[model samples]
Target: MTFTDVLRYTAFSSDPEGGNPAGVVLDATALDAAAMLRIAADLGYSETAFLTPRPDGGDGPGGRGFGVRYFSPKAEVPFCGHATVAAAIAVAERTGPGDLVFVTSVGEVPVTVARTADGRLRATLTSVPPKVEDIDPADLAEALAALDWAAADLDPALPPRIAFAGARHLVLGAGTRARLADLAYDFGRLEALMLRLDLTTLQLVHRVGATDFDVRDPFPVGGVVEDPATGAAAAAFGAYARELGLVDADADSVLTLRQGVDMGRPGVLTVELRAGDPRIRVSGEGTAIPTT
Candidate 1:
């Protein structure tokens, strides 16, 4: 028999029921990939975090470093932002909020946890260097068809592209909030397309204000119909927006992403881009979910 301590946390919201929930394992030194996958599948969240302390006593006080792995119910993912936040907060609750370094499949990620003015813990993760690529016309058409969205329903300004920070996400900008809402996509179709493209999610967004937007992610590849609050997609969208000059790319700017509203689990994600840096910063609050 194998014993594993799994912690439940909701990231990107102060309310436990209002954010994306993730399973977090603080110490997974003894678990292998099969075990981790089984644990994640059992939890049935979009992604779960598994952490093993760095053998070298890597960084931060008392060598606050870990080798973090993210797993969806069906498979392992390169990186997961919300899970990272949950894991960071899980550690901070025990060791006090501070800086920590995580060696992920994508790269080394630096995270900072601090207490907010309202006395809530907030975690911010800096993403790996990101890049944006234009999607093939046929692929874009297929994706739109799967989502039941026509070209006219898309925002001509944002354009479609695949963006990668820690993970690859297809970014599609909706022309209107109504278009962004009413998400009814073909699961198998989207999953097949995502698998072919090696995509983690489809970032469907609608720009409300200059720096404010509503976003949704279709994560069929992760065995989840939809992701309530997606930090990875948010990071990728930030990179795409910057590259397209949708936001100020030459200066520091912060963008607000409102997600999960249509799903009734509303959550907010803050994305920051600094001048002269290709990396994106995603920040959100996480709370532990009381288990019975």
Candidate 2:
């Protein structure tokens, strides 16, 4: 089997200590599914992205793009924001800064990379069409039970729902920021429920201000307790806010998401919403992690 050099990077935050780390295989045309899974398992990151050149003149019907796939150690995911950012930067390192379209399992995602003033790389990914759905009360109860959290621990304002961008996630808002910090849960039970629900992660959040939120993600299905930062969830949250009419669509709205603070790896994600665009823009700085 052919093996390509993979780069490790954390996206959505400047500090290496922040953001979610993803394995980036910029070129994987020669690798198959089993090889990709093995690589992801060996890297042991939350997700790994494998990029292959699209067949000549096969970039969608009229779009000129490449195909990309994301894989966890256990299984393949439809899309992964952190892995997308890492792959964008990886491509930019060789191809220079510009637009790159990725054909994902869910849909096509357009990512743009630009060099920042401090000589850092910033990647912005415009998500596919997002949708939100009301979660069943019984499922919410089951989830709460799995997490060992009571109804009183949940924030009444935000409510709970299953939100989807490229993937599905259960959004749970905590009554207080402190409650969000304490995150001991039944790993096996939560993992089973998440698998049964086809959920990617549990987007646990706490509203600190009208435009600011602190978030955490429980990714038992991916064999991880918590993701440092999640861009897909941030995009889905933007859609959820728009669907709920929490922000004016005609105005430029920006939401700041603070994640990974409880895990000692703090990350900040900026979610942007434009009036005419249905796609959410998730942008953040990424840093390369040297492979040993």
- The per-candidate count of clashes, in order, stands at 0, 0
lDDT of each: 0.93, 0.87
Q: Candidates' TM-scores? A: 0.97, 0.95
TM match of model 2 to true structure: 0.95
Candidate 1 off by > 4 Å: 1-3, 60-63
Model 2 clash number? 0
Estimate the Cα RMSD of every predicted model relative to the unseen true structure: 1.9, 2.1
Candidate 2 — which residues are off by over 4 angstroms?
1-3, 56-64
lDDT of 1 by residue, 86-190 (tens): 999999998999989988988888999999999999999999999999999999999999999999999999999999999999999999999998899999999
